[model samples]
Target chain A: MSELLNTLMQDARVWQGHRHNKTTTPSESTGYQLLDNQLGGIGWPRGALSECLVDQPGIGEIHLLLPLMQRLTGTGKTVFWLNPPHTPYAPALAREGINLDQVVMIQTGDGGDFLWTLENCLRSPVTGLVMAWPGKLATRDIRRLQLASESGSNVCVLFRERRYTDQNSPAALRLELTPGDHQDLKINVIKRRGSWPGQRCSLAMAHRADLAFRETPQVVQGPWHQSRR
Target chain B: MLWLYLHFPHLLLDHIRRDRQDQRPLVIVEGTGQHVLQACPEARNRGVQTGMRLKTAVTLAPELGIVRAQPEQDARILEDQARWLYRYAAHITLVSPDGLLAEIGSLQKLYGGLPAVWQTVEQALDEHRLTAWAATGHTPLAARLIARAGKGECTGDRGHILRTLETMSLATAEFDAKTCTRLQRLGLNTLGEVFALPAPELARRLSPEILAHIQKIRGTRPDPQAPWQPPHSFRQQADFVQEIEHSQGLLFPLQRMLSELEDDLCWRQQDTDSLHLILQHRHEEDTRLRIRTSGPEHRADGFLNLIRLRLEQQPLRAPVVALVLSVKRFIGREAPAGQDLLGKSQDLNEAWHTLISRLQARLGDHALKRLSPQEDHRPERAWSASEVQSKHKPRLTNPEHLPRRPLWLLQGPQPLTEPPTAWFSGPERISGGWWDGERVHRDYYIAQLRSGQLAWVFRDVREGWFIHGWFG
Candidate 1:
């Protein structure tokens, strides 16, 4: 009976509750101390799928991945961006110390092609990270991506609309982002691999003084504006 | 000076058999479509024989498939067979219409022995599904005569070859009809009977051509052979007996052609990035499909997969009768950097190239792109999307630093109807494009909207506010 139990425990399908804290999968730091602490003392899970849920664009979502991208490209690893919402501005990426030569941008036509490109990138050995904006995905799609990432030993992050917050996923980690006060991003860890859900962490995204909201300039009457006034 | 000759009795018939999948009774008729030139084994099994009239052969085998023979096509097929033989022997001569003469004496040591060389050629013939009669002789003419008689033996012994030649009939000696008839009238039915006569007496009785031919066959005279060289580019065509109705039916013949191309590329130590596939239709214009790879590739599997994907996208419009695969440009193969000679671990660059090729094959060729910065200040012109480079170049450190830019730039600026709640910085003027006649004067600012979205807003000379980008 003990030998049978040991064999059963070796199978990945059997989830043991007591072995939660002894996770052996490697992970990278998320660059936020509070979020890192909430994520079982490690950062983003490596060789696994992670999902980021956001309602709108430009709310510090891309800023959250800058550190990982910089670290990856600095070490001669490739980063793939599949079907991004907008153009990945080159000057901004270069300014962040990210190697543009190591970056590849892929734009696919349909959902099938998007999924195929995503899976290929995740399974490629030379890939450091794969970031995609897969609009909607089924449960099976996410599971396959998770398996591919685990096999390739790379990081894969999928950005989805905030409406998918209630749907269950097989990702290693899931986070929901909303705007916070004073240019801060409110990150709510809805689900984690080895931790309880609903942990909150606020991260400051904008560090440049020129990006903060200041007093509005007074309106000046010019020749072109005279007609409008 | 040992010579080897390969005699293909049914070259066109064998070629047609290789293209199709069925073992049907087939025969190659003369150019006049009157007599049978060659009969396949399936047809011969049914009592249909060569040199028989077309009507007679059709009666003998009612289900026989007849294909009219063309001398031009026969010559081409013979040359293709010689190309295959070039890999085994260095000096190959194309004997037009159905034979190849190769000097294999020098290759005996290279291939270990005469038997080894013969075995190698036999295995290659079997692999290609060809029926050939091979023989070795002291002279080229001797080898040809013995092989044509269907009594060829893979022996390099001078005495054995001479004895075999002497036993051949006068007809198999390949002499002109006039000379053979004259010699037969003189009571010389076999080649040995003619050789027994005095040389001067025979030369006086017959024309000088027969005497010179005999001397050359006996190795007393030199027979110069023009060596055959492989063409610079690969081009081969497969003509079918039955028309292929579906594009899928073309893959069978295409598989053989692609493997041949792979062998050619490997032999040349080169790779190609483009392949042109032409399909000939019976009534319509030829359909052409061009397959392209991101980097140089020489694998047949990769090319076949790309062709499959392309065919799936747009199928044939008519029944195809022939297929032509050709590659014009050849790229010299370079060993991948940082890869060990033993190849214990897969090269990362090769993996990257494979992924890119697979994506491009399924998706269109222009789906993937590389982003590089340009020397321009206009937000729209600040970056460029170009083809991915096969080799990655290291980035240079630019000493000049530019101002802040957004993470995501909109394709086109949208007019801002709602005013921003706060303005952080503004009025950094950019006025340019005057030399290009598309002048632009704008004041850019960082503004915070009511929804807390950081926007890169610009005001034109007309005082119209437009949102240009987002800081994602």
Candidate 2:
């Protein structure tokens, strides 16, 4: 009877009410305590697909992943960036404590390579994290990536436009991000496994104020300035 | 010392018949194309004997296929066979046209005994579908002569071999016709009868060349053989009787060749990164395809897959009659670095190499790149995208307390059209690149745009404002 119960529990369709509060999915910390609390203290889901919907390009999107990147790279695991919108600044990444030697960037010419590279990177055991910005992916494509991530036992994060929010995804965790007031970020947990969805959370992104010059530059009138006017 | 000799009666005939499925009669004619030098079993069954004139052979077996033998090509085939035999014996001498002489006296203990060594060669020949007459003798010439005479037996006993040689007729003694007639006239009907004659009298009667031949066969004079060494590069080709119209048809022959290469590489304990394939057409120029791997690889499956992808991408322009595969560069293989005492990392490096090569085979080599930071103040000059490296190197320590930079820098700075709605911080001056003509004197700022998108914008001293990068 116990062996039969174990086999039944292994099935995906089987759901037990008492097991709801216990999170069994392998997870890693997002490095942000507030976001960790927002995720029910389980942090980011590992060995699975997590989708992020962004409102704009900037607004601390990459900052949210800095802690995880540092942790993964520090352990000598490779991180692949596939078809990002812009060039990943090496100096910035290096400064953020990411090992430059462990980072690989792949640029694909067409949509087919974009999907192929994402899948290959996620399926490789050597890679610790696969971050991709696929322009448009089919439902089956997303499902394939989910399966590959589970098999490879790596973290895969797909960043798409907020326009894809309405389309259903097979990701284990889904979140939507928008710019918040006071240079902060607003995160809404759209979906997660074995947890209540629609959990809204906000995190402060004001640490970037140190990057700007605190004192203003004083400009004196010069002969070249007069000639240009 | 014990020596082994292998004589291939129909090397070229077997090579050609193995490529095709047809069981029709086939024969290899001499270079002059008049007399048949060798015949297959099918032709032999039809009573087309060796040394028969081409016309009569054709009359006997009308469906017989004849191929004119080229001495140079036959010698090359012999060398290929020697390469395969090198796996079993280290010291091998190539007796050209269709024979291999291997020094096996030193290798008897390594193989346990003479019969075991003989069995190993016989098994290899059977697996390759080859027919060879093998014999062992006390001398190289004796082994060659015994094998050529079709009285080969696996024995190392000097007395037994001598007894067998004694009963042999004078005709098969490999003597010139003149010496054979002379010996017969002297009432010497067999080699034993000839050996019974006094040595001084025989030496005085026979010419020095004939006398030396006898002494060499009798193991009185030392006959040294030049050892054949494997070539530095590997090259093998296959010719097809039927024209292969499709590129997919070439894979069957290529698979066999690649496996041979795998064995060759394994024997050498080396790996290769490149393979050159040439497809010969009837009327068109040859199509050459070069397949490369990211690192040293020896597995035939990996190479076959890469070649398949290459053929799929660019197909044959015309029907091909022959295909050649060559690998010139070989890398020394290093011990595998996997599975430490903890056994946590189980051949991950090998899997990584496979993934890189597979991705590069479908995508171009330049599609994948590694990013390493350089020591330049300029953002564009500070980073470089290079080909993936096989070895990992220590990383340079990044400078502490650096100003925050954007995660994504545009390929080139774009012009900013509108002013910012609010300025969080501004007027930080960055002026550099004076040594180079492309100087930059600008004041950068962190500003919030009207669309609520934070931008890293800078105003040039002589030019308008421009946006450089995004935080994402």
Grade the docking of candidate 1. acceptable
Per residue, candidate 2 scores C-alpha lDDT tens digits across B376-406 of 6666677888887574777666446556677
Model 2 TM-score is: 0.85
Top-scoring candidate (TM-score)? 1
Give per-residue lDDT, candidate 2, residue A139: 92
Candidate 1 overall Cα lDDT vs. reference? 0.84
By summed lDDT, the worst window of 10 consecutive residues in model 1 chain A runs over: A217-226
Candidate 1 RMSD to the real structure? 4.5
Q: Measured with DockQ on alpha carbons, how good is candidate 1? A: 0.43
**Model 2: colliding residue pairs:** none
- Backbone N/Cα/C clashes per model: 0, 0
- Per-model TM against the reference: 0.89, 0.85
Can you write out model 2's per-residue Cα lDDT over A1-229, one digit (the tens) per residue? 9999999999879977667676788888899999998898887788899998996787888888888889998887788888888899887788788987778888887887788778888778888888898888999999988987887777788998998988999999998988876567789999998888898888777565453333331222111222322
Off by over 4 Å in 1: A1-22, A208-229, B31-35, B52-66, B196-205, B340-346, B394-400
Candidate 1 clashes between residue pairs 3 or more apart in a chain or in different chains: none
